[model samples]
Target: MQSSAKTIEQYLLELPEERKSVMNKLRNTILENLPNGFKEGIAYGMIGYVVPHSIYPSGYHCDPKIPLPFMSIASQKNFVALYHMGIYSKKELLDWFVSEYPKHCKTKLDMGKSCIRFKKMDDIPFELIAQLTQKVIVEDWISMYESALKR
Candidate 1:
């Protein structure tokens, strides 16, 4: 569900009490692994990591006013979702994630093009998540995003 929170703190406070710990774990992983230049804030109603207007003045091609989004973590109605734009835009990254995640987590992955859904806390592979988050630097992400826009 989309949150009505204006800030990350507000977003955390608004989430169901049962989901706070899981969210915190995932948030911590993202924060620890997230490269410099990507700012975290509430975007599209979720906690989002984005290339701010300061770095990418063009903003998101889809919506020029909003920052260019890289990743987001959200507590959905039935599951926790981790969305990674790199995986969505890069086939090699997608392949690597799909193959390596199961090996690392030892659990079947439930994922869509860019959204990985964790139905329970144990389903999350914290280390693997960090690794994935670290794979694409802000510059690389901007390049990939710009290349996709050319298509």
Candidate 2:
């Protein structure tokens, strides 16, 4: 579910006790592994990691006022979701993640185009998520986003 919390701290505090640790671990995993040049903040009502406007001045095409969103993590009504733009835009990355998922978690991969839904929070694979976080650097994401925009 979308959150009204202003800061990541606030967001975390608002989460149910059951979700707090999991979301924190997931957030920490991403923060620790995310390549430099990406900033963390609340975006689109979730915890977002973005390529800031200072780095890519054009900002997001859909809403130029905001930074270019690369990834976000949200606690939904029934599941915790990790949204990575790279997997949606890069076919190779998608293939890699899909292939690696079963090796990491027993649950079938529950995913949308970019959103990976973790219904069974206990089975969340932090290691695989860390690897995925490191796979795309800010420069590459900017390039991929621009290329798609031109298409």
All candidates: CA RMSD (Å) = 0.8, 0.4
What tens digits encode model 2's per-residue C-alpha lDDT throughout 16-118? 9999999999999999999999999999999999999999999999999999999999999999999999999999999999999999999999999999999
Q: How close is candidate 2 to the true structure, as a TM-score?
A: 0.99
lDDT for 72 (candidate 2): 99
Instruction: Look at candidate 1 and tell me the lDDT of residue 5.
Output: 97
Score every model by TM-score.
0.97, 0.99
| Cα-based lDDT at residue 101, candidate 1 | 81
lDDT of 2 at 101: 95
By TM-score, the best candidate is: 2
* Clashes, model 2: 1
User: In candidate 1, which residue ranges exceed 4 Å CA deviation?
Assistant: none
**Candidate 2 at 37: error in angstroms?**
0.3
